[model samples]
Target: MAIETTSFESRGERCAATWYLPDAVGERWPCVVLANGFSGTRDWILPDFCRRFAAAGIAALAFDYRHLGESGGAPRQIVDVGEQRADLLAALAHARRDPRIDPRRVALWGTSLGGSHALTVAADDPDLAALILNMPAIDALSGANVEEKRKRAGVSRARTVAITLRLVGAALRDLSRAARRADPLYLGVYGEPGEAFFTDPELAPRFRRVAEGSPTWQNRVAARFLLGAPRYRSGTFERVKAPILICLAEHDLEVSADFIRAKAKGAARVDIRTYPVGHFDLYHGDAFEQVAADQVAFLRAHLGPR
Candidate 1:
């Protein structure tokens, strides 16, 4: 049950991570570089899941994105998809070179934005063995639009576009300010008082936890992410070459079916499992523990002999 833990420098960043590997495993172990949630840090969650993967005899690497958690970057909680994807690549490279890992069997287990990036990355890397997307944030704009699908939400699409563009501009302005190490949250961390994604029921508790624990939740995402997201998902659904496993939360206001199926068009294989739970349920509670077991079984059946 005791796996080795360590820290390393990657991507010109100081990355804090843990390596979970069971004793008596084969010489070349398959490794997984777990990507954290979009607005969350690795410390806030994933350590438990990392342990589960380790007990399954899979070496797992859990790390913070550059601007979050123990990783090095500032305007400390900024979100940049392009840079984080690069960080994922750097983490993968580090995992592949790990002495206890097998490069040929590298897999990605990503949550939220990390999940989508994992899918997009694996799409181009045909050597990737498999992918596990846990309540992934496939497309922010699309997921945000799903609410409109049911309740009209009384929102104007043009207004959405305009405000989003304004936010993006604000984010750009912050980046410029950050060049001189100025405080980015001149207005406050979150976009609006209650207009953010987690303002809904399914995500409120998790959002509260973020407020209590990370202190970074007050950090705002670069508005540019909204613009780049649609482009990143371009051809993503159909270009993936690896087998896919999607863990959907029935009450997950975030992970939408339309998002995953749309991007998985070219994936060699796909499996979708939905649980009667909320977005945060996958991390804790008896339900998630069992889900973890199922995930291990799935990984064992498809990615390993253990």
Candidate 2:
């Protein structure tokens, strides 16, 4: 397998990307365009999946969304869902135009929050060969059963309310700052209990481990994004015509497994796979192996050399 550094333009900003090519050269290969989850960079856990694809005779393009990682953008680490979707589309266009990739066989792969973008994008893109969502955060906040989620995470009602107030305050403050052309307010991506967006004590270390050596992976994002996040729902699954693979973690604390299962029921060509693990577990160990293997098989079956 071979890797190359590249960039693509998205809404006038340059997004950094890594191209993983198969050993067999001089032939166009089916490609998968990969995007990371919430506040995740291309370097975090995505390289492992990209390497697997390249080794399996498929090309993979892993990209960092603008304003994050090595991507070019000012006032960085903003997580705008709409802009991220645009970045994914731009990455798809870049992949389709590459001579080393089979334009007609380009697939979309997204994990966590990235999966939500993939699902929404694939809904309108009928030409995509396939779509793979790994432990996707589809509904996110809007359609989520917050009470159930909080209960599962052992978070009390008082804590949930407090978190909500903090999030709202931060978002409002960031919005005011934006209007005044000042720097955006930031929020930690993960922290000790009650200190960050994701306060899970056990998962915090795992996230840090994933981002261990990543130079561009920041542990924070613009707080203003929280204001528009709830409205950024991924409800286009039923509109997607391509073959879809949706991986779910039964014990996911970040994304509700039951919500995804219910939302997927409306889709026509979805294949659901459930694992006895949490959201972060899907990125490593036996769980990662099983999920990645299943994804490879799905991609190979659907995007065969053509």
Q: What is the TM-score of each candidate against the true structure?
A: 0.83, 0.95
Model 1: lowest-lDDT 10 consecutive positions: 186-195
lDDT per residue for candidate 2 within 13-89, as digits (tens), equals: 89999999999976689999997999989888899999999999999999999899899888888898899999999
**Shift of residue 22 alpha carbon in model 1, Å:** 1.4
Q: Pick the candidate with the highest TM-score.
A: 2
Candidate 2, residue 207: Cα displacement in angstroms equals 2.6
What C-alpha lDDT does candidate 1 achieve relative to the native structure? 0.70
What ranges in model 1 sit over 4 Å off? Answer: 145-181, 186-197, 211-227, 230-234
Per-residue lDDT of 58-91 in model 1, one digit per residue for the tens? 8888877777777787667667777888888888
lDDT of 2 at 169: 90
Clashing pairs in 1: 112-137, 237-263, 237-264, 237-265, 238-266
